[model samples]
Target: MSNKLFCEGRWTEAIAQYQKLLEIQLGDADIYYNLSYCYRQLNLLDEYFQALQQAIKLYPQEGKLHFSLIIDLRRNGRIQEAILNAENAAKCLPNDYTFKILKYLTVPSIYENQEEINFYRQRFIQGLQNLIQQTYLKTKEEQQSALAGIGRLTNFYLSYQAQNDIDLQRQYAKLVHEIMAANYPQWVVSLSMPKLQPNQKIRIGYASHYLHSYSGTLWLTGWLRYCDRQNFEIYCYYTGNEPDPVTQQFQNYSDIFHHIPYNLSAVCEQIIADKLHILVFPEIGMDAQTMQMAGLRLAPLQCVAWGHPVTTGLPTIDYFLSSELMEAENAQEHYSEKLIRLPNIGVSYPKPYIPPVVKTRSDFGLEDDAVIYLCCQAPSKYLPQYDFIFAEIACRLPEAKFVFLRGTLLEPRLKRAFAAVGLNSEDYCVLLNIPERLDYLMINLLSDVYLDTFTWSGGNTTLEAIACNLPIVTCPGEFMRGRHSDSFLKMLGVTDTIAENETEYIEIAVKLGLDLAWRRTIAERMSQNHDRLFDDKACVEGLESFYKEVCSKHFSA
Candidate 1:
């Protein structure tokens, strides 16, 4: 009965059946394993862990069970335990490439400090090397599994790299695309496009898994809302499961909105049926189905923008639409697609609706006089090497407090990162609860200075800071992802806070934190220049111009 229920995909019913079977025969490892699978499917994480633990205990040498437990542990935020189990799983299943790859995926979430990050990063590279070496021996089925795993999340690989190497990033992205292409070769071949009818509104489709209040939503909403409805008919193909007010708002602005079903083949067929002249995937690498579709000729012209800000590495993608200010002169060479540099800072953002600050500094237990430097980027954005900057800032300003928002799961790693530079987490940094959007904005408004992450810089947060008229001190790196704040600051005509080097980054952060007059003047200037950055209509106009150029080229071809 349990097996039947599991086979039918009724995971909740399967769990109940498994529990009944378990009550009858308590020591069955297979039952526990099946129970764990059911628990995992239902996302009852604690139950999943317990069942997996029991399964692992009963079947000590079972490599697959250990693998399942590793995932569960990580998912449940048992970071240290997850790492230990991953290592154990690798030892138990020395030849299994999945276990080895899983180790690299889990390691970055919980680094101790610079040394550990460096050590694991090297191990990850070595693991990739090993994965490539063993690929030749695998069966056709196993090879497909390995290829499917490769592009599951390329963001992990991009983030794991010690430094920003655009070449290597391109390589990683290209490899993933190749794997995906190999699996779906039909998608790689260009479809025959019909000539566009004169005077017909060009249908522009935006594809993404995040159509809610996510970064992709935030990045594209302004353009969607303000796009020239007369010339361009906008269609939003949202693939996310969660639908919120933001999703509804996007639907309201769009000529047509589709909640794309999960079936990949069906999704492709639906998109093709729409006969879209152009399709723009705001984010690709993050979603498997979206990335797969992106590898296809769903439209005459398919382009990608900087929702996640990494290369698609797919041949089918025509242009990588980017901001003129954000990208360097040689940025075109880094992308797989033809680079389209839009005038201004690229997309115009909607003006932020600043909610009343319902809560005070005392509510968050922040000291009244402390110079709070908020480093609120996700824990993954934090490279261990950047910990020194925080330490230096704390040292220079004794009354300083660094607030690292979220990543309670990454506490062990974060503590170690800070501890490496002789700064304790308690003394230097405060971990705050991930507040609601309005509260987060309020926190940004209240904070003294925003310290932008080096590698994967803040995108939406940078815009939010600018909206709140808060001062941000940024250190732009080699990649486009690191240059968001730099672009925004430059666009806002405020360059004093743009740090050229790590030394400058530290100097600027300290200067802003200490000098009240200088900081106030910059903040005031930011408020004055907010209109320059929040030109949503201008962004739409620029985007429409680009679209016209691309569509014209497509039609002429």
Candidate 2:
């Protein structure tokens, strides 16, 4: 009966039926699991936890249930417990590689025991090497059969590690290509087409899942809006079918806009049917389907911009379009794609919409006189080592309160991280989930200084901070992913807050927090220099020139 309700998509009715079944006979573990699913779908986390716990208790040997609980624990910021659960699952199913991969992926998030983490890291590397060896030694057919799961695990490993090392990043990316070559060896597609007229518009297509008010959407919207429409015919292929005002605006600018509701193959077919001379992905690696499609040869010239800001590691990707200012001196050595640097901050950015500051410091429980330093990047962007930087800043500015946007599931981990560095929870605060964009902007406006994350720096958030005229203090790291705000600040002509190293990062943040006059000077400069960074027309022209060069080279070949 509960199954009937569940199949009919009646989650509340299914919960009721499950409750009735539990009242009559409570020993059935499957019933409890079903109830947990219903509660999870309904967003009743407490009830979901209770039901899942009961299910696990009733069926301790069920690996699938254990895995589900492990995911739940990890999602709720219980990383250590999640690792332990994965250990138990691995013990229960020794042959399964999933649990081992889970344990490996959770290692970076664990900051308490460095020695234990080192041990697990070594074990994971050794296990991965062994898997790669075994998989490579297999026949083509066997490798294809095993590549699906192995490919996914390798991608996860690369995603986490890309924030850390470039050499290891290259290795993991090569492993992905190896898997793809084994599975889909015929990636290149041959095209027989007519030559373009003397002044035909270059057909270009931009594809992604984020076509709304998101990181990629915001970064590429200006390009779509201000591109040389006469010389470049643009097509937008959005996988996310949901349409908002931004989506409608993109449609208004694009010559052809497609909201792809079909599968990956169908989406690929649509692109091929368009016969685009060039295809661009604003970002890759955030979605599995996008990554898979990216691994295929889709167009004559394929390039990726700093949307996700990492090496794609696919041979089909021809160019890594990066900013001239943000990348390090040795940036090209890190990317698998051929590096192409664009002047200024690369793509044209949408003009920031500064909503009215509706809330006050007092309304948010912040003291009127205290210096507030805001670090609103998502939690996963934070590396465990950067806790010391925050601690040092808090220590230097005793009256300063560090603020972070909440709901990133890093509250407990952050508390532990700060405690390890001798800073108490009282030294910082996490602002609760702000649902409205205006409220988020208000928080940025209310804050004194913006602190960027160390490795995976904030992209859209950095622009929003600039929009609010908030002075950002950034410690640019070794990779392009960590340099978005660095580039933005440079483009804004405010390099005083861009720190050179970790020590300088702490000193700069502390100086900005304690020194009122200097901080205000930087803020005023940022406000005055917004035009340098917000010049969408110039950026679009640069992009148009690059597209024309790529098209000319392709057709000439």
Best by TM-score: 2
- lDDT string for model 1 (1-557, tens) is 88999989999998888887778876567778888888877768888888887787778777668867876576555667887887777777665646656765455454446787677666656665664455543356655665555524344434534364445445445555555566666666666565667877989999888888787557588888778877988988887688988899889989989897566666777778888888999876777667767766788889998886777767778888888888987887667788888777678677777876687787788988999998788766777667678777877898898887875655665566668767776777788986577678878878999989886788888888888778999978787887888998988899999988999999999999889999999999999988888854666677899898877876777
Question: Which lDDT tens digits does candidate 2 get at residues 1-557?
Answer: 99899888899999998888878876467777778889998879888877877777678766567767777776665767777887777676555545655655444433333354456566656655655554441476555544443433334323433344445445554665565566656655544332588877889899987788787667788888777777889999988767788888778889999888536667888888898888899887776567766777777778888887888777778898888887888888888888888888887787687977778988778888888888787655765666667667766777877777752555565577668767785656555667677777888999999988886787889988998889888877778888889999888888999888889888888888878899999989888888888845776777788888877766777
Candidate with the greatest lDDT versus the true structure: 1
Q: List runs of model 1 lying over 4 Å from the truth.
A: 1-51, 56-68, 72-107, 110-157, 160-185, 407-424
Give the range where candidate 2 is weakest over 10 consecutive residues by summed lDDT. Answer: 153-162
Q: Which stretches of candidate 2 lie over 4 Å from their true place?
A: 1-17, 25-34, 37-70, 79-124, 131-171, 174-194, 407-423
Superposition TM-score, candidate 2 onto the true structure? 0.84
lDDT of 2 at 157: 29
Measured against the true structure, the TM-scores of the candidates, in listed sequence, are 0.83, 0.84
CA error at residue 425 for candidate 1, angstroms: 3.9
